[model samples]
Target: MDLDLAQVRAFVLAAEESHFGRAAEALSISQQALSKRIARLEAGLGTALFRRTGHGVEPTGAGDRFLEPARRALAAADRAVAAALDERRPPRVDVWGHLYAPMRTLAQVAAGSGAPPLELGHGRDLPSVAAALLRGDIDAAFGRVHPPLPAGLTHRLVRLEPVDAVLSADHPLADEPALRPGQLRDSVLWTPAALHRLDFLHRFAERFGIRHHAEGTNLGLDGFLADVAADPRRFSLMPADVPLPDDPGIRSVPLVEPTPLYAWSLLWCGGNPRVDALLGALAAEAGRSRWLEYDPAEDWLPEPAGEPA
Candidate 1:
């Protein structure tokens, strides 16, 4: 019996996510379709692969045994496809957290004469970027890498950017030279999306005892900054290097006495030569720009999965 790669892929994603709904979303397929593919995969193997739990599904003994091999098989297939494609085609690189403008760093890297040609794209977040990487839709992605990264992906931390608190010029604290996280405790923490989705911001607020939280629709960075500028009680954190809008009403004050640092990492599946070239370029640029500097005693960063690269 032969296995359909599509069915195998669906089974792999389901196993990784534990929840069929989330797996389906990652694969950009309907839950029913994912279920059908998984069922067919199980039938072809003549064994049950998953057992349902109250929360979702868990791989059975057979599935746990098959997991590593399935991953290797997919990697092999991706490599074969890459070999047949036009070698001159630039590697596709995607970015998340567009509000922070990850492209600024990418552009800096690409400006070097030794950098490889790259095709750029945008992803909604880490999950979507992971899905695209596993599918071989993109060669690499740049973003904040959190724990339990998707099964086949690897990452290298590239930069640690200082964060600043942006507020309306008229706010009570706007005149301060610099503010500590504690100073903002009584103010509302405004965000571009819900608190749950913005992990870094959520943790920042929690760590600082900033009790009040508010969210606004993401209407581009300018609009988001405008919203923060419009409310005296609202304040938001932004990467210090990100250029603010020209509006005079916005005041971007540095967060000192433990400046919050946003971590940027490069993620990839590991077989592409172009990925290696890009990584080299990024490493060189990062070193020259002092992009990886961090001092835990004087800076704030969320608990990371691994040491910075």
Candidate 2:
């Protein structure tokens, strides 16, 4: 028998909440509508699924038996929708955080190498990019990653970048040649939530007692720097490789102390012959480049998990 997914989801929620009012609120529907949906579902299955109690509603014996299966069905429906959406999208490589390095690699590869040209675009932060790669929303991406990737992904080392700070041009420290990690003990720093939430950022800030404001601010990159320029009380860190905007009001300063390096990687899904060739060519180029410091001899590089469908 064909089952209605919405009704099944409603049934599961009502059973779990054990109160029609609470269940409807959770589902963002009225209690009367929730009652009707449950009633329709119960009638379809020829059972009395709930009993009105003094305090609320209690699931019947049959309702208890059906709840687990209903939840499973709802989950299966969600997966089906996601899969269908992925299939409809075109293939592209997504840049999770910074686009400069990865774009440079791909551009060089497209120029001299016989590898297929790649279309690149911006993807979200770490975990979100991870999800999109697995879901087939993008064929590959570049971002900072440490250690083993997800079950269906692999990474190639790009470069290890030094920690640097961004400060307003008018700030007292802007004219300094370089920065040390501990010089900001009583200072205020601002970084987007995504960047500052990294374990490395948290640990480094805590050691020096640096007060950080991680607002994931609405101000775009230029606006963010402009705000920093207006307020000498703020500062933020970046990897030496991260491209800095040429705003006269702001400056990029390298943090000479070398503990928390930004490890960038080229992340990809498995088994596209063209993409695999492209990755091989790109890796070869990186190994030869002076700035990248890649080593083809390193046994640490992991292969793609398995062929992408």
Give lDDT tens digits, candidate 2, residues 151-184. 5567766654456778878677888887776776
Candidate with top TM-score is 1
Off by over 4 Å in 1: 1-44, 49-72, 84-86, 304-306
The alpha-carbon deviation from the true structure for residue 229 of candidate 2, after best TM-score superposition, in angstroms, is 1.3
Best by lDDT: 1
Model 1: per-residue Cα lDDT over 67-144, one tens digit each: 867875776687787688845788899989847889998999999868898999999988888877876778899988
| Residue 288, candidate 2: C-alpha displacement in angstroms | 3.4
Q: Each candidate's lDDT (Cα)?
A: 0.87, 0.64
TM-score of 2: 0.58
Residue ranges of candidate 2 with Cα displaced over 4 Å: 1-91, 98-112, 146-149, 194-200, 207-209, 214-218, 241-243, 291-309
